[model samples]
Target: MVDADQTFVIVGGGLAGAKAAETLRAEGFTGRVILICDERDHPYERPPLSKGYLLGKEERESVFVHEPAWYAAHDIELHLGQTVDAIDRSAKTVRFGDDGTAVRYDKLLLATGAEPRRLDIPGTDLAGVHHLRRLAHAERLKHVLTNLGRDNGHLVIAGAGWIGLEVAAAAREYGAEVTVVHSGPTPLHSVLGPELGQLFAELHREHGVRFHFGARLTEITGQDGMVLAARTDDGEEHPAHDVLAAIGAAPRTHLAEAAGLEIADPAHGGGIVVDERLRTSDPDIHAAGDVVSFPHALFDTRLRVEHWANALNGGPAAARAMLGHDVTYDRVPYFFSDQYDLGMEYSGWAPPGSYDQVVIRGDAGKREFVAFWVKENRVLAGMNVNVWNVTDTIQRLIRGRARVNTEHLADPHIPLEDLAP
Candidate 1:
């Protein structure tokens, strides 16, 4: 039983934190809620940064979750440009750096999120080498692209994940010579599986994007204040004018660990460990979004998904638990990526080597298809490329834990809606 006057301090003002604050207010919790964000801007959507924002198709103001006036009207205090330096669990306070303010909370939500992983290779700190995470990063990249003369600049991306591919697509659209170096056998192989990944490889190649699959970069060399070349472990060198490191991201968990909270093992991958109810080891503190690892009932495994859908859905679930109404974060995970006029949607969970059956719902050669991962007649996961409606149907089917015959799933004539539970 918590008092209505008690304060709730939410660290990190990304989508998760903003959604939690909104959920708290919507659920009729009239306590003092303060959202602390490190960025100058209010909580903004990050997925568009690599695609629409990078391509200049979306305005900066369009990224914000809510207007500043909205927060003021809702009585939610927005602490912009403030970084949480430390967490004092014993004192139930968080120390911020910008103002050196120590705020105590009756309840705290950790949504510090993640930072872009950097390449440890030599000369990675040189000029013309960058990593995209914040709006500042995108602005810097945009400046570089604008000044470098799109027709002549060579952009080298160091990963094949969604961010790397999206950035590559934007760069290609601007007429930059784009090349992606990935250690994986195919782009998005780990997420979409090999067969579908192969299709993406062909698509990118057809668009004049070069790929170095299974190639590991050993070092980045700079010449005369600019990135000159990248050397690979296989003794090959590739010339480049700019380098973008998109190796992935790790959870920002230092503050949580310093506060004596149980952290997830690196074996389970790096992130804080949380229960199904989104509560950490300390019930007074909760965690959600990309920073927390929790068990997935569908996959029968623990996963830390750094997707927009997870942040949006899990944040509200955490708020429910904080307000003494425990709700499991069991929604089927979904995410999207826009690359080169193609939209991709992924739903459900699929552990490596777990799916025994895979069915393609449409023509893969035509650049529109839905690949379903099935285990023991149950739809475990799905990835749809350029098929929007199928993704929505798959999302509902996943939530219902629908079981379907793989044979019918492969037949394009069989309506996917009929597979509903």
Candidate 2:
């Protein structure tokens, strides 16, 4: 167990790091708490970057997890705009690159998060090209969209993932002509399945966004250091005043690797490997958020979730474990997304081809529905789209792992509570 005088250091200032700091204080640990983040701003949430904040529906202040004064009030030391260049495991210190300041820690928690993947195509370094992972990126993209106008604005998006789709929606709302080119057969097909992915594709098309599925982006053509067009594998080119490469993000694991921590193999999704308690190979250190790939106690599979809920919940769980608590971080994975009129909440582990069938309730065509993926008569995962007030029940069905009547599950009249075991 950690003593009161020991210094507890947290790396990464997103939702996970902030929550870990809050947990350390709430758990009555009076240790010296210090949070180190590379970003200049205080801890903030990332979802709104592509949704409300991008659409100008939310103010900049609301994006922060907590105001700047909260850290001071909570007696936490803040190290903003600093990069941890190396972890001196033998010396038990972290070295910062900028000022060469080394901070000692009795216990360390890593919530390094993930970084947006960049395309290697030509003209990627040109102006008017963006990726929506950081606050600064969103700010610049919003400014470009606001000034670009509808008449000649063409936004080319590479990747049909959630970020790509959400940005497409926001661009359309701003009256920009948008085009998405993805290698997948449909948007979000790998996760939501083709049926539901097609629904989202149709949604975007109806809103005046063009999608080219099974297409490869050959290059991003530009002139005078400004984006002009993007060419595809078929030699077809689309107008592109701006481009968003939302291919996906990779977990930040260089620090862990330098410290000789266990990292999962590329064949196994390639992330920092940890146990159920979110403890890395070194017991003195712990990792959470998108950076750590920990074994799932319920499913017997390792998972590295990049969703907001995981960071919000996993950070606290790791904090508890750092304080010498035997923690089994076994919460079913959950995530949600907002695009256009669709709001979706999904829970449980839905591995590829794991479910035998997907049962639906409500009207999918109307975009108000609940879909449950079932394997061996048990609910593996469930997603509620454009529907409100039933996330708790959906989580219960997944956690309980009980067989339910398909007819009852498919009936809107039959309450979800009645379907529970």
Candidate 3:
């Protein structure tokens, strides 16, 4: 166990880093705890950036993890808008990128989160093209969307992932025409499979959003450094006064790489490699959040999850492991999204091609269904769409690993709890 006099340093002031500081204090770690963030604002929930905040339903202050006074009250040092350039593992010090300011630590936690991925296409740096990752990005997009009502222009989204669909919904709510271009045949096809993905595609279609499926954004053409249209590989161009490229995100792993940590293989997106306890190769330096690729107890291969719940839960697990406590950082990965009038909650890990078949219990056409991904009658993952408060039961069925009856599983009359072992 670390002594009370030792100092703990946490990099990246996102939800993961904030939660780690909270966990350290709650776990009775009296040592010095410092959180360094690159953003000017305090740590905040990012999920709201795409949904409530972008829609102006939530205030900016409410997105922050805590008030500015809360950090000082807890005796936790807050280093805002600081970039950590490098980590000297042998000396246990993290140096700043700009002024080379260095701070030594007894234990370091790397919660450096992911950044939005950008395409190498033309006109990416144009004025009207944007990507949503930070609060600043969302605020900028919000301003553009506010002007769309007067401009009478359309928003062209480059990807059909969770962020793309959610933003499309919000933009449509604000009276801007929206068009989505995706490489897949249906929205979220890689994750939810065609059946469920089509349901989402249909949901957006019903809400007056256009989709160009099986297409790639070849270039984003602009006039005078402002986005004008997004052209696709199929020789089709869609008018877009504003463009949001919600392609995906990549883990911010430059610091970890420079520190000589064991990064995951290139095939696995090259995240920092960590054990089940979230410990990096260097015992004193632990990694959590989207930047980590750790072995899952329930899955065969190493997995790296980028979702709100993973960051919310993984931070505490990493903190417990840092205190010389024996811990296995294992939890059923969960994620949720709200698009238009539909809301969904998915639990457990089922990568693409992992599950053989999907069994649905309510009407998918009506947009109220509980879908279970099964292989050999063992539930791999489950999703409840427009259905409330059954995630616990769904997760249990996946963990129990009992043989399930497909007929009963598809019967809406059967309670999900009864399917569990």
CA lDDT of every candidate: 0.86, 0.90, 0.90
**Alpha-carbon deviation at 19 in model 1, angstroms:** 1.0
> Considering lDDT, where higher is better, how would the candidates rank from best to worst?
3, 2, 1
Output the TM-score of candidate 2.
0.98
lDDT, candidate 2, at 20: 97
TM-score of 1: 0.96
Query: How many residue pairs clash in each candidate at the backbone level?
Result: 0, 0, 0
Sliding window of 10 residues with minimal summed lDDT for model 1: 143-152
Clashing pairs in 2: none
Model 3: CA > 4 A from native: none
Q: Between candidates 1 and 2, name the one with more favorable TM-score.
A: 2
Give candidate 1 misplaced runs (Cα > 4 Å).
Answer: 148-151
| Backbone clash total, candidate 2 | 0
Q: Name the candidate, 1 or 2, with the larger lDDT value.
A: 2
lDDT (Cα, tens digit) per residue for candidate 2, span 30-79? 98998999999889999999999999999999999998999999999999
What is the Cα-based lDDT of residue 299 in candidate 1?
A: 69
Report the error of model 1 at residue 81, Å. 1.5
lDDT of candidate 1 over 1-421, digit per residue (tens) = 7667899999988899999999999999988999999998889878878988888898988888888799999999899899999988889899996668998998999998999998988988889899998988998887776655444788889999988988888888777888899999999877777867888788788888999989978898988888988888889888888999999998999989988899988777678889999989998899999999998886677889899988898888998899989588877878888888688888887755778767888888887888888888888888888877777788777777767778888888888888876
lDDT of 3 by residue, 1-421 (tens): 6788899999999999999999999899999999999988999989999999999999999899888898999989999999998899999999974788898999999999999999789888899989999999999999888888567779999999999999999998888999999999899887888868888888889989999999989999988898889999999999999889899899898999988899998687668999998999999999999999999867777888889998999888998888888889878889998887788999987756888889999988888989999989999899999999999999889888899999999998887788887
Please, what is the TM-score per model?
Answer: 0.96, 0.98, 0.98
